[model samples]
Target: MSITLTQLRAFLAVVHSGSVTAAADELIVTQSSVSAAVSGLARELGTPLLERDGRGVRPTPAGAAFAPFATDVIGLLEQGRRAAVESAENASRTLRIAAVTTSAESFVPRLMQAFATAHPGVGLTLDVGNRDRVMGLVLAHQADVAFAGRPPRDARLEARALHPNEHVLITAPDDELAARAEVAPHELAARTWLLREPGSGTRSVNEDFLAATGLAPRTLTVGSNGAIRQAARARLGVSFVSRDAVADDLATGLLAAIAVTSAPAPRAWHVLCSGVGPVRPVVATFLDFITARGG
Candidate 1:
């Protein structure tokens, strides 16, 4: 038998939720129906996709490989359905956005408010996460468009430079480094740095800047922008963060910008969308709106 959308959905739910019972709850179907769907899908593919776990289930190797395909298929089908519905009902447009944390906390609100004022009927959904998570949403087709501090490298993604993103070195107002007019690059290697997670765009940029300047400082990893800011405020360590992210703190003396002689040059914030396919009307309209406003 040919594979069916329902079967794929059921299989994906099970894989994501980790159990037939949980998948049934998510799909709003009975456990037996979910079980039957998984069985049917496995039989159609001539391989077992799942194996039992302790009191739950896990994907077999074949299932793990198929997960991306399953997510992509579901995403595409949902997009098509939304496109059709929105084409017939112009007032019911929906746009989805994924944004990096810095943008999400700073500029995204103003952008969203302006867009809503211009197109009041369009329903908007925004997902705010770190850079890696936002990129993953775009790759998974879960977001119609994304805003990020750095351009993506994947062939499936297309990006436009929106605006300049300036990263600045920050320290507690009382810290010794804050009073310097311009800290030399050689002096930077001795400072304790509060760093974000390894895969973060901010961290990557900081690393690249350090590599170019031959400065390697001791780092204490913090997961979130808020945490990093707090750490810097408490004099736990100094940090590099988006100017937009620390604007209020800088203004109020909660944090002070440390002028460094060899600081990183401004990088462009990017507007990214899938390059491999046609964008939906809502997505197109939002892209045009943002680009016109210089993002």
Candidate 2:
């Protein structure tokens, strides 16, 4: 017996939705079915695909490496079907978008929806990951457009400013420094700092801030932005993150921003695309819409 589409779907569902129960709900199947499919696939592959994480679930390193390939396989099959149907109609078109984690959680959805609403004939699919994965998609010509804080300097990619974005150092609402006028770099040296995994733009920003200030604190690498947020909420450590990603939490006093010297310089969110060749019509159309309407 070999791996099946059923197993792939079940695995991806749990990866995306973060739990077997959630995956079952998303796939409209019983939790046992989702669990069995994932376990069976892992057994067939001779590896564990998931690990329990503090009452939830997380992809094992092997599973994390496998996810993008699995996503592409499903996406390509869907794309082929759409291409066949759209060729007959001669009216429908598909657009693929990729965005880094922060933008994907924030304004990118609204931008996508506005474009989709304005152009009802276009089919939109989005892939969200860290900066490295998103840029990989753009450089490989797998995605029509991408959004990120910045791309590594690459001659083949063109990036235009979408808007100014800011990162803030956040802690639980009752942190000791929240009442201070300002914090010094040395004051933070004794505290623990939360870092995103490598290849993440947030980690890049955190590194830049630390470098500029010459402060090295105890650092713990949490894998994702959501985990960092939860860590901050639990007072596990301080984290640097997009304001947009935690605006509501800040406003509601669930998280507090602490002011510090020479930290968190403002950066711009950019719309990115390949500069090496002609962009597809659907790609051009989306760029025009956002350029005119403001993403």
Candidate 3:
């Protein structure tokens, strides 16, 4: 009998997730079923693929060598299946998206909700990460579309402007900076600042503002836009973020937008995809829907 896609998936899931229980949970199968599939696959290959590691499992040397092949086979099959489904019944295709944290928190979910309402038969998946991770998803073909606050620097990506992403210097409502109609760059030079991790799009913009103003304030790095918002609201430090991310907080008087000299130029929301090929129909549909929404 030929090796089945199910067997490959079971093996790869275990290898990637580092445990059979986690793989079973992800696959929605019982641990015994996952073990059986891996065992069956090993029998078909006439070699051992995995072995017990303490209470869990680890891929054998042979399994490590075979892992990439299994992944590629599964990826190719998924691509072929998506192509067939799109050609036969376009409404059933899945649209996969990856977006940076700011876009994800501020607009991407609502956009996906609206898209789902308009295209009820289409399956959708949205993954959120930092700018680098989102760009990596697009480059790896793991996501059909990518959204960010800035255009991707990768030549392999084709980017389209979506909407203006207005960034503001935000502080707690009670902070001294909050009382200013406009805070000058020099005024910001010595304050403590809260910002996103180094590779995030927001941090890139924040760094540009810092460079333009020649300010190197003491800074703390947080992993998500939500965290930064919370930190700013707590008066931990000021942060620069897309206005969309803090609109509710701004309106509620929880956070104040501080005007700053030599602020980063207004950046636009961007949609990106692989530059070299035609996208799936569902992806095209999502792209059209988002572009029509004015970001």
Candidate 4:
């Protein structure tokens, strides 16, 4: 006979609780039911799954080996249930969004708050990652929509320009670079440059800026905007990042933006969705809100 989910669950509970009585209590069932379920599972697998130790229970080698797989199966089932519930609730009034780090850090929270206020009872999930990863999430249908500085060229996704985004050279307030209201691109290039990972939009813009001016710097690559910011704050090196990401720091004088003549003009931020068909209603509503608010 095939292994039953019920039996697996009972076995896992017993392993977790370390005693059949405790497992029964946790499962809100009788101890006999737990014992019978475990025994049945062991018989089906043709192996001894548990052993009594003094006053408690312990998994035998076979049971211990099966525990992880059983837990994973149960987890997947729970996740499937959650996804179904989320999908149904989404059909009624929920929005699932994925965004690159900058957009998520700077705009998403406010957008979510406003969206929630405007559409009460609407559920929302926002996943944040780098540009490529966020786009992938949207393309895979894991997210209904995404926001990023530039839309990807993937054929499976549809993208629309939302608003212009500016990148600024930032440095710690105490750093010598902070004294300059604006540093020429070539001069800026001479400094140690902290940068985001290669695929990030900010990094792309930074590279473009260097290429346009025919300048390269001592470069140190970091993975996230937060890391870039921290590195800059530690006075390790200057970094260029989205203005939105550093707005608060710029305002507070903890960090300063170094103007550069050759800096790329602000580029358009885009909203991306799957190319399959008409956008979902919740995603549409959010896109409308972002466009209306001038992003």
Candidate 5:
């Protein structure tokens, strides 16, 4: 007889639990049934997978090596079962998403909540990172979809504009720099400016703004939005961030926007996908939800 997935699962349970009784309890079968399954599996593979040592069970060297493979097989099989059930209930269920840090915080969570409400059976995974890391997730097929300020120029990806992102300079409410409605890029050139890391999309936009005004500050790189926001709150300097990210701070008077005359207009936020193929249904659903909400 062919080895069944059930037999593989039983063997894995026994190996993981390290006792036939425990494995039986986990599998909801009798200890004898679990032992029979393990023995059958061992015979099918033509190897001794386990042995009794004193009053406990231990895996043989071959079983120890095979245990991981069995675990993986059972895991994939269980995932398949779950997917099949979900498909029967709602064929659109799936997982795989990537987003730049700012959007991940400001927009992605709401989008996910909406999607979850619409498709309760769906499995979801959201990858959050900087611009380059998010793009890398998409290209590597680690994520089926991604959200970012702008798509990379790489020919192997497809990007569609989802919304407009306005950049603003933010400072603590009590900060000396908060009084001005606007500050020239050169005015703070000598100051210590908090910024996202070099490869961040925000940093890139900030660089363009500085370049346009022929000013570059002494930048202190902090890799995350939260870190940069805290730095700005501590009056470490000032930072240019997405208007959406600082909305709460703006509303509560914790931070103030610095108007810059030559600041660029709002840029487009794009949803990026690998050019490798058509978008998955879950990814499409998320994109549709975000775009519909004006992102």
Candidate 6:
């Protein structure tokens, strides 16, 4: 029997949601329907695709390997549908945008507003995620454009610098370090630091800053920008975050920047588009706006 899209979707949903029951809930289908689809898919592939893990489900090695293929198939088909719709209905043009959390909170809104003002007919769909999720959306052809603090490394993608991104060490306004005129790097080593989780672009930059300054601090991993900002405000620890992300806090005396002898040079926020082909009309229009803005 041929593998059908229904089976593919069911299998992928189960793989993502980690349970047949959860997948059924998400897909609005019966549990038996999801189970049968996945089972049929496994049989057609001649291997077990999933195994139980704790109270949920987990993809086996084979299932894990097949996920990208499944995502690409779904993403490409969806892209085709959108393309056909856009062609037949010019007034319904939509641009799917994905952005890392920091940029989403900081600069993406202004850019989107300006773009919308310029092209009232085009619709925008913005997805906020961490770097990995944003990059995956772009790579899968699910996003027409993506904004990230750092450029993606995939050669299949093209990237452009949209704006500057500056990171700084921040502390509670009343912290002793905040009063110092020029704090030495060694002084920070013994203090606590609020760090982003692994695989975050912010975490990578923070690590680099620590290594470059030749200091190590006791670290606490905080998962989100808002939480980290609150932790800093509560005087729990210092943190390295984008100036853009903490601009209002800094301006209102909620957080203070430490004056250091050597600080990280400014990086950039990048606009990324995946795939190596002539640009689509909507994407090209956005890129042209980006160029004009950046220039």
lDDT of 6 by residue, 47-101 (tens): 9999999999999999998877776677777777777788894449999999989
What is candidate 6's CA lDDT for residue 280?
71
Number of clashes recorded per candidate: 0, 0, 0, 0, 0, 0
> Per-residue lDDT tens digits of candidate 3, residues 21-128?
999999999999999999999999889999888887889999987886676567656666778867784436788889898888888888889998998988889898
In model 3, residue pairs whose N, Cα or C atoms come closer than 3 Å (at least 3 residues apart or on different chains), thus clashing, are none
Residue-level lDDT of model 2, residues 1-295, one tens digit each, is 6988899999999998899999999999999999999999899889999999987899999999887667656655654564566667576788889999889999999998888889988889999999999998876567878999966798778887877799989998999898788988778887789998889999999898888888888899998878888899899989789998999899999999889888777988889987755556677788888877656
Model 6, runs deviating above 4 Å: 139-142, 151-158, 174-182, 197-199, 207-216, 220-227, 248-254, 261-265, 276-279
lDDT of each: 0.87, 0.86, 0.84, 0.80, 0.79, 0.87
* Candidate 1 local lDDT, 1-295, one digit each (tens): 6999999999999998999999999999999999999999999999999999999999999999888788778888788888888878444988899999889988988999999999999888999887888888987788999999877777778898888899999888897866878788787777787888866888887788778997778889998899999999888877779998999999999999889887888988889987755788788888889999997
Residue 245's lDDT in candidate 3: 89
Task: Mark the 10 consecutive residues where model 4 has the least summed lDDT.
Answer: 75-84
Model 2 bad stretches (over 4 Å): 1-91
Q: Work out the TM-score per prediction.
A: 0.81, 0.70, 0.73, 0.66, 0.67, 0.82
Candidate 3 minimal-lDDT segment of 10 residues: 85-94
Better of 3 and 6 by TM-score: 6
Query: Worst ten-residue run, lDDT, model 1?
Result: 82-91
Ranked by lDDT, the better of candidates 4 and 5 is 4
Candidate 5 lDDT over residue span 164-269, tens digit each: 8998888777866567776666777876778788779998887787787887678888989888888888888787899989899899987877776787788888
CA shift of 129, model 6, Å:
3.3
The TM-score-based order of candidates, best leading, equals 6, 1, 3, 2, 5, 4
